[model samples]
Target: MYHALLLLVQKLSYEVEEQIFSEVSLAIQKPESYFEMFKDRLDERGIDSPIDELAWISLVDSLLDHGLAFEIDWKESGLYICDVVDELLDRKNMACVSWEDFEDGEFDELPTSLCLNKISGKLKEQAISLASLDIESDCYVLITVPSSDTDEMKALAKEAGYSIQDSF
Candidate 1:
């Protein structure tokens, strides 16, 4: 049930997130029926569902006024309902990909060779690309390197036809 809610909230749309947040804000006020509406919604989606497990959201030991975060093994990346929303609304260079779009399996490869950057260590540090929740507007995908490497990432993104967004 928690997993289903996680996947649903990972909807990642600003509008949807706002709706969920509004619903949560109201539901949290009730304390007892916090997840009742969520369960009903999930059950409705269970008919001919993509995956199994018609999860009954029982045992609400505590209130989840802030919403639940689930780290599922189904996908290698952890899905955060809030982080994705924040970056999408505030960041200009970032793109939002829906779970359904992912299911379609359409993809393109960037010029990854440009990711090879020789930072201070003089070691060839490779910046990888992925569908990430913890993302920034500086460049597409998650660049896990020092601040110095951001220039290289921006260069790579621009060279790859990705625009450097001045404002969102």
Candidate 2:
């Protein structure tokens, strides 16, 4: 089974952090009401806010403000959202890689240095990506790599002056 991992490195203002937490908590606890409140926004984005997938939806919602969102198709293990900052949008320095990329063997085209696998854990041999690096406003970067590649990711993170804030 191939599982997906999500990682975020950013410093949030206390107000923004609190808002995200509260919104996500509400979405998780009362998905129906939460969906209703954000229905128009979600609809504008063409996302289906199903109550059963509250956890995933809430995560997506929380990150939406940061210009990040993941469209997860659970039944198919599909991840449809992959956004990278403009300058490094090529295959070599992609900010995000979609499920389609994996199915299409795109990872094989990456250099070995960029190819990362989890060093330990149930999620082994999974390909990872640096995803996004926002240095200007937030000094934030997002990584979607497997646990095995954590050391390499950490090294890169350190060089970039970002400490890991959250991982999933």
Candidate 3:
């Protein structure tokens, strides 16, 4: 499943370069809305179904690869739907990953920005994969990845110049 998600992201990155795919921002901002809009356009209609819990979780993780996922704390008083966009688009705390903004990749080389999602409480390193990217402005997104420990990840994030909280 993780591999599949990685492939999807990589494919989407190429699609972006080719101008054949829709922008990542819209997809991350309103996944359900967009799904409803394009549900009929899909060739494999039988495989289409409402996103399940597992699917949403994985989708959120994939959004990170595009550097578009934001962590939300819904327990706060009087949370509203608008708050979701506010929390995610806030430039102060967001971590932007751009493949071109960092360095070019050779064959077998990893892109500077990568994404990994963990299920349960365990983080698996092999779940990580790089995005295939080109173009300078294509670098405007935030992403999350797997780490062994919360403290260690936090330290790494700090070193990388992002204000991300430790993921335990």
The 0-to-1 C-alpha lDDT of every candidate, in the order given, reads: 0.29, 0.39, 0.32
Q: Which of candidates 1 and 2 reaches a greater TM-score?
A: 2
* TM values, all candidates: 0.23, 0.36, 0.21
Write model 1 residue lDDT over 31-140, tens digit each, in one string.
Answer: 33444545554354342322222221111111112222111122222223224322432332333333332232221121221211111112212221222221222222
lDDT of 3 by residue, 1-168 (tens): 333333333432322322222322334456566566545532232326444322323333344434444433323121221233233334224232222321222311322222111111112233322111111222322233433333443343344333233221
Better of 1 and 2 by lDDT: 2
Which whole-number lDDT from 0 to 100 does residue 83 have in model 3?
37
For model 2, the stretches where C-alpha displacement exceeds 4 angstroms are 1-15, 45-49, 68-83, 86-168
Q: Which residue pairs clash within candidate 1?
A: none
Please give the range of 10 consecutive residues that has the lowest summed lDDT in model 2. 1-10
Q: What is the lDDT of residue 160 in candidate 3?
A: 31
lDDT of 2 by residue, 23-117 (tens): 65666578788888788766754657654445334544565454442222212111112223122233223233233434455654543223322
- For model 3, the stretches where C-alpha displacement exceeds 4 angstroms are 1-12, 18-24, 42-49, 52-168
Candidate 1 RMSD computed on C-alpha atoms after optimal superposition onto the true structure: 16.0
* Model 1 spans with C-alpha error above 4 angstroms: 1-13, 40-71, 74-168
Q: After superposition on all CA atoms, what RMSD does each candidate show versus the true structure? A: 16.0, 12.7, 17.4
Query: Judged by TM-score, which candidate is best?
Result: 2
All candidates in order of lDDT, best leading: 2, 3, 1
